[model samples]
Target: MEITSVPFLNPEEYSLFCSFFQDFDNDGETSVNKSRKIDEKNKSLSEILEVIDETEIPTSKFEIPSSEFENRASEMGDWEQGRVRKGRNQSPATFHDGETAEDGGGQRRRLWVKERSKGWWKYLDSDECSDGEFRKAFRMSKGTFNMICDELESVVMKKNTMLRMAIPVRQRVAVCIYRLATGDPLRTVSSLFGLGISTCHKLVLEVCAAIRSVLMPKYLKWPDQERLQEIKTTFGSISGIPNVNGSIYTTHISIIAPKTNQEAYYNRKHTERNQKPSYSTTVQGLVDPRGVFTDVCIGYPGSMSDEQILEKSALSQRSKLGMLENTWVVGNSGYYLKDWVLVPYTHQNLSWSQHAFNQRLDELQMIAKDAFMRLKGRWGCLQKRTEVKLQELPMVLGACCVLHNICEMHNEEMDVELRFNLYDDEMELDSSRGISVNALQARDGIAHSLMHCK
Candidate 1:
């Protein structure tokens, strides 16, 4: 090709010549001094026409004008159109086609990245859907959900505005309740609630803590004197047992093996078919005649016997100190016979009055057992292996017990499936605690009264 030097070509002519080199491959780095001199003057059109006429340069190569080519010089190599995109300080040749050598080697360029998921909490919006959807999604009636939200608002609501907004207290409490009601894993709850996994975990703990601290006292407590009289009357109606203050029992909740003390949480009695320790936590409950929990003692290791749990409990302290007075709480053979605690005679031989006492005691025991059944039934989370950390499981279970009472107050229907298939922890006979002389006299007195009065 003949090269010609002319004072800059006219605008139109320069465009035409520049378009001709668009297909040339400009691959790999070249120093500034050795780089192509794109600013240099080019031959006039008349001179380029003479060269094209003499040489056999293919016409097909430059058929398409530069105006028609897409600018892909940043990442893709245009073999036909060899032009390369350039950095501000670096020449186009400083980077090979498709090589990520810009702004130093292989470091990722900063980008406007969005890490949040949008509108996951939308499911809780009442106006967006039907009441049935709300109940199914949150596992509670809208009214119940809102009531809980209102009560928890003061505690669960965020107080800071310093950073990204905190999750609304409603959503936070809902996440915790929904997890408990459904026994769903944290990941599932997080996805359903449109929260991060860590956020969901935090919310569960926070909400449970709030429920334990705020609602538990209001819902689950030792009945006052008047309430105690009412409870005794209810028990009397169920069976002829007199002075029955409450019924007591224990149920074990499954948990993952603890990292701190694996053996402590291991309930040897709950061994798998292969005889492996099944780790669990025990929740001991005292229920009124209506099958509502009045008192709950949670966080006892499953390995601890029921009598041990009861002896160490506040209820026992209250009873031993004469706080209960004439009031007597009934349990199965698992508890020691005490002046304030009545257990059915487990001896093989029995008098007719003793037989009558045992029968009435069995009825009272069923009331407490059924309370646990209804509790675990209503909140299926306790039925399954609770995935919460061992330390947090106490508050979580305590919260569920409180909710159980609230649900009972509101007449929340028991889950039919769980009601029939309720789990009952086996009871052990602790008859060796040596029945109190006063307790034995009281039991015989009640039995004699029942026999003669009837």
Candidate 2:
């Protein structure tokens, strides 16, 4: 017997065979009957294949003539040209080349650069540019723009989750205020960002309130005994005194009034037609020699006398404590009180008064004057209202004192002259009007003798 081999079917033929077999139901239990049916189908398929292989047709039987072929080609060309013409007529006017479309009865289209004049390019709206030209003209970095857009999208999504309505404009306005308080000018800030001046002003006030509510408690603190001791040690070197006595400085307030009279102005004075006296709030602050603000009292009427302000100040109570029994305090003649506070150069010397008591009192006055002169050099006249309101004034004064003490401490031998001018230009003596100077001098002499014996 001779062995024969059959060639494998190509991909197309195998696919077709698989498709035919896929239609059969394999769930039937009659295996013999199913096999017989499959054999019959295979026989039919083989016979069809054999017929297709053996069949032959005449090439010229169904061929068209060359003239007919050319005629069909021309018909196709005509049909295509007609279709193109129909398309051009039905399309939008905006889509047509070389024709500008009006805004009415058509979509508004951006004008191209070539359609515009040379100078008109400068005035061209941003919407009129190609994507590339717009990006270049705006000078935006691709990465930065995308990152900003993404961040905005994320913020919008987060906001929408909790809010049913849009976020209010004031909530965004608050952000502007924060920038202003932290040191940004309102004019330069919102101009580029498209915000109005009034909005910026309100925002600044709101932010200031918020920050003050949080920060005021921590930064504004009262000084304790420890801090007072520290201040004493710091001022001691400069004053050449073993301990520090209290001091007081005075300042005034500024009142602003319009140059021209307005409806708001009411003239209290009937005689003086042009005179309008302005008014301002008066503030008094008591600070230690080290410039640590010990107490502050505000809301005194501008016309209140300096003596009245001092009498009401917390320093008045401190002075009553008898701390000045052996110590000295620095102040102007405004604080000149006989018994409680020591007005400088008020003590009298007599024949019985030891020379040492007079010398010590003179030395103390000199030291106080020296400190005042140094303060005056650094701070000019504290009487000025505008300069006092500058927030850095207190800090500058404190820092200068610290530096002065440090210099005095490190350089002990350097002799510096005391430079304060006395407030009273002339000494007044009235022997008959009051306790005679001679009697006061005798009392001081006795006190000094007793002090030396002790």
Best by lDDT: 1
lDDT of all predictions: 0.75, 0.41
TM-score of 2: 0.33
TM-score of each: 0.72, 0.33
Clashing pairs in 1: 23-80, 23-81, 24-82, 29-93
Query: Can you write out model 1's per-residue Cα lDDT over 1-454, one digit (the tens) per residue?
Result: 3333434456776686775466233444354522333333234546756655665645455344455344444334434434322222232221111222233453333222225443655745657777766766555677888899999899899853322346677878888888887788877887777677888888888999999899988888888889999998989888887788999998888888888877777887678532766888899999997788887788988788898899888888887788788888899887888888898888888999899888888999998888887777667688888777787788889998888888778776654555735554565764455667998899999888777775
Query: On a 0 to 100 scale, what is the lDDT of residue 21 in model 2?
Result: 80
- Deviation (Å) of 50 in candidate 1: 25
1-454: candidate 2 lDDT, tens digit per residue: 3334444566776765775586457665487867776887687678658865765644455556799779789767767888533323223343212344434434433432222122322232234555444223222223322332342333222232111222233333223322321234555444433445565555534433433343233333445668757755755555433344545444333333324432222222211332645333334444455443344444444445445666786666665775444433444444443333333334456334334443443444444444444433322222222222333333323322332332233332222332223221122333234443553454364346545553
Off by over 4 Å in 2: 1-196, 200-216, 241-245, 257-278, 317-329, 338-343, 346-454
Return the lDDT, model 1, position 117: 46
